[model samples]
Each structure stands twice: as structure tokens, then as C-alpha cells.
Target: MTLAPQPYLNTRVSAMSERLLTSDQIAALCELSLPDLAERFGLEALLDEQLDRRTKSRAVKQALINTLLDELRVLIRPMNATEAGLVLAWGRKYALFNLKTLLRGQLYELDQSEISANLYELPAHVRLPQQELFRAEGVLELLRKLEQGPYSLIARQGREVFEQKREPFALEAALDQRYYGEMVRRLLQVSNQDGNELKQLLGAVLDRVGLLWLLRFRFSYGLSPSETYYQLVPSVRLLHRDRLLRLVNLETFDEILAALPEPLTSRLAGSTSLMEVQRRLGGHVTDEARRTLANGQSGVARALAYLILREHGVLALFSIVQGQLLGLPRELIEIAVEVSEPNCPADSLADAA
Candidate 1:
């Protein structure tokens, strides 16, 4: 008989529930510079203490990225099947993102060494040296290796785009939309329970991600309706593809905001930039998770909440560290960080209904 995996995920969920940082901790974090903040709060210690390196202050930019990868892998290592699946899904997306980064970085003739340094390595893949990556022979070979994995479709699409002398942005968008769309479909199909708050929270994230992509691609990147519509990953049922297409086709951002649905519209419409909109969207999603967890949806809510909490904490740490190294003001970092972390009321109404 095959041995069963340990049930320690529940124990971990309980532990995480306790450490869900208080509002005071967030306020304190908001007040400190990257270095001082890390040292004072032991954020620096997470790097040196947890991972055993100082994560040099001046190199905080790269260090933040590396630490995040390491920390996330550590967290995911012990999770149960469902819990691990959630993390794995997000990880695959980031891996896809890194692939896009490599393609763009190489195509733009960025230094091979610098490009290699920026890549995020998953436990599955072998790392490549930066110095040799620029040479066409090595780039193709790396892509060949990556092509054998989950990214085969994207690698194929990228090749076509490369041949056509077109940017891979559209292809990237399509891959994201397809992946998330499938995920949402699978989750809903498997979950017969109508009141699953975990599904609701995940749906909210999907909708927001789609909304952000639609808004950003349409406004910032100038994607047409077909392009924007085809690239959306609808992990949630809230958004209608037709509606998204219509919004992107609108003449102005104000008009687009005016047509948005309740709560989301109100939160996102206030932002003059995509970054601001993303911040509000992320906060609302976290709030939804907290609400779900409060209403007795332990397994799913616990899973979603943990992911949100981890992402928010790690990303904030990354931002502050990067901001300080860049000499950006604390205020700027705070504003930027807000996009990823929100100050939600811990006692908000439950989402079980």
C-alpha cells in the first residue's frame, strides 16, 4: 500500500491563522525604510536567519526577488494536495512569466549575464549561466529544454511570433487567459457546493486579474477588443467576456470606470494608474478571503487566505527593499505597496452567504 502524505497542512493553517499580522505591524512597516525596517522588524533576519545570507542592502533589488522565490518554495513544500495545487498553479504562472522575461530580455539584446541573474528558478529546472545566454546557439538550446515542460504551448506560440517579427505580448496574454480560464472552469466544475466562499474568493481574484489586464492592455498597451478579450483568464464567473470587450472598446477611462460593477468599480475607479487599481483589487480579494475564512469555510478559505497573506507580506518586503535601494521615498514605496497590501477590517462580515 502507498503511504499517505502527512496532515500537517491543517496544523500549518492553524499556525498561519495565528500569525496573521496585526494592523499595528502593518502600520509600523509603513513607517520604516527598507534597511531599518528589515533590521528593526527582523525582515532582514528572514533572509539571513531563515536563508542564511545578509541579502546585501545595496543589492536589495535582486536579493528581494531571490528571497521571495526561496521563501515561497519553503512554504509550498509541506502543503497537502489541494493546498499544494493552489501554490503550484501560481508558481506555473510565474514560471511562464519568467519565460516571457527571458524571451524579451534576449530579444532586446540585454546583457546575457544580467538577464540570467533576473530569472527565477523553480526546483524543477536547471539554471543557466548569463554570460553564455546571449549567443543564439545557447538561447535556442535553453528554449528547447523549456519546451519539454508545461510551457510547451507558450514556447511554440513564441516561436511563431518571433518568426513573424511580432512582439510576444499578445501570445503571453493568450497563454495567461487560457491557463486561468481553464483553472476557474475546473474549480467550479469540481465544486458542487454553491456557497463555497473559497471559490468566491478565488473568483474575485480571477475577475480582478482579468479586469486589470483588460484595463491595462486596453489603455496602456493599446490592445484591441479581440486581443484583449482573447487574453483574459477568467478564474471567476463575475466577468462576462462580452462586457470586458465593450469596456475596452470605450473611448475613455472614465467611461470604462462608469460601467464597472459594484464594489469593484468603486474601488478601482479611484485609481489614476493601473498600479493603483491593482493595489485596490488585491486588497479587496484579501478582504474576501478573510470574510470566507470567518464563515466556516476552513479548507478552501484557509488555503486562499494563506496564499494571499504570504503574497502580500513577501511582495511588501520586496517593494520596501527595492525602493530603499533605489533611494525612493518611503511615501512612494507605501503607495506602491498599497497596490499589493490593503488595510482590511479584520472583523468584516462573513462571505458565507
Candidate 2:
């Protein structure tokens, strides 16, 4: 059955697209430190002007999450039963992310108070408890608590890995890939004939994600090719599953770089740094989505508009926080941030970094 068009959702998304920073605003942000920027501007104040919270970095993150949820609430509040169900399906992705983050925070033994501070309140579903999550005794109990969700497999694998005393990054990556894969599947089911563009954009998103995983896995932890490929979420345009499987056989970063597609080859333009590769891939994906949205298709167009705004806010926040945490120079961080688009070529970005 065809659902009615949601003009309100479209309008909110359009408004959000309008408020995103331009090249000039981004350039200006490049110069400010996190605290300095927080004091100088009220992020939500400039947009909704409804939030009364102080304009700190954490506040900005909270405000972004809240604003998105507020839009979702407004869109769904008037939805009929059937439409509301569809909306709920979309909203579950964010809820799943928060749930997994909570569980991982528990596994890592982060302080309960700190974990509570990190909770992203959602528009639906009761939140998992930070205290229970952190004190869950072991991974088994953690997985048991999360049995109600779709990511049970990740928690299960995490349990096995924990016994070996390895960091959970691989497990986390695998979980994300699986979740996003499933989300895409759901999207396709309801996407209608007009959703092909959205599907393509999603495919590109998966490709970028796979690229990041391959590079990070091979470089950061020095995992064997087989081990790295085993954890990869299985959809990418440029590299087949077998190629990544074979990538494990390559001995050096240069060899892996050589094996990447032409579009991703630019990732090798500068330094061979894995972190820089991540930043570049992010920028590349955002830029591609921005371009795709400009082409003006159907639901895809609106999704692209909101997705880009969401990603920009997130990437900007990550740059600010990571820079602040590492005490890196603002100049270096900005350079890294600039390459966050998917096409910028990781090599050049790394060289600049």
C-alpha cells in the first residue's frame, strides 16, 4: 500500500539543510578551539532557539540528538497507525546505536556516572540502565540484557573476544556493519520505486565504511588478513569479499593501498596514517551524499539532506573533541576535518595531516 506524503518531515529536513554551515562557516570553525567556539556561539540557539541549555560541546551533542528526535516526534505524532509503524522502524536504528554504545561502555569498565552522561535519550523505547550496564558482572549478563535487540550476535562474539583480553573494536565494527546492513534492508522494503537513489547512496555509505574497516584493521592492530576480513561487514562496491580476504595476504600498507579502487586511491596521496584515512573517507562520503542530494530525486533527496546535516554536525563534533582530548594544534585538526568528504583522496589528506 502507498503511504501518504509527509510534508512536515520534508519541511523539517529542508529547514535543517538550510541551517547547515556553509564553506565560510566551516572555515571559521577551523580556527576556534572547542571551549572558545562553545562560548562564542550557541549552536541550537542559532537553529531552534528553543533549547535553554548552555552552549558547551557536550550540550551541542545533546542538542543535536534532541533536535533530531524532536523532528521525529513531530513527524510521527500525527501519523496514522500504519505510518507510525514505518517511522518506528526508522527510529530503531538510533535506538540500537545507543543501546550498543551503552553495552560497550559497560564492557570497557567506564565509570557508571560517565556512562550515564553519555546516554542518548531516544523518542521511543526505555533506555538501558547505565548502572546495570556497567555493573553487569560479565559479558554474558551484558548480552542477556540485550537479547531483546537484533545485535545479539555482536554481544556473543564480544564475550568470546573478552576472554582473550582483546579490545572490542573489531566486535564493535562488526556490530555496526550488521546493524547498518539490516537498516538498509528495511529501507529497501519500504523505499518504493522512487527509492533507488537512496539505495545507491546507502551503498556508497557501506563502501566507505568497508574502506575504513580494511585500513584500520590492517594498520592499527596489525591483524592478519583473515582476521580482519572476518570482521568486515559484507557489502562494498569496490572490493569483493574475496579481495578483502586476500588483502590479509598483503604484507604492507602500500600493498593494501595499491589494491584499493581508483576512487579510494587518493587516500594514499599523503601520509599512510590510518586515522587520516578515516577522516578522508568521512569527507568523501559526505561530499558524495551532498552531490547526490543535489541531483534531486524522490525520498532519497530528503534523506540525503537530513543525513548530510547530521553527519556534518557529528564530524565537526568528533574533530573538536578528539583534538581537545589529544591537545593537537587546531591547524592540524582542521586539516584532518577538511578531508572528511569521501572523494578527497586519503593520501593527500594524510600528507596534509
Give the whole-model CA lDDT for all candidates, comma-separated.
0.58, 0.58
Q: Cα miss at 140, model 2 (Å)?
A: 1.4
Candidate 2 lDDT, tens digit per residue, 165-233?
555664555456556555455555655533555555555666666767766666665677777887675
Model 2 off-target regions past 4 Å?
1-12, 30-56, 72-111, 125-136, 149-171, 187-195, 246-248, 266-271, 314-333, 339-353
Residue-level lDDT tens digits of model 1 in 190-281: 33332265577777878788777777767777778777776666545567666676776787767877888887777776565565566577
TM-score on alpha carbons, each prediction: 0.73, 0.71
Give the least accurate 10-residue stretch of model 2, judged by summed lDDT: 344-353
Which pairs of residues have clashing backbones in candidate 1? 279-339
Candidate 1 has a TM-score of 0.73
lDDT of 1: 0.58
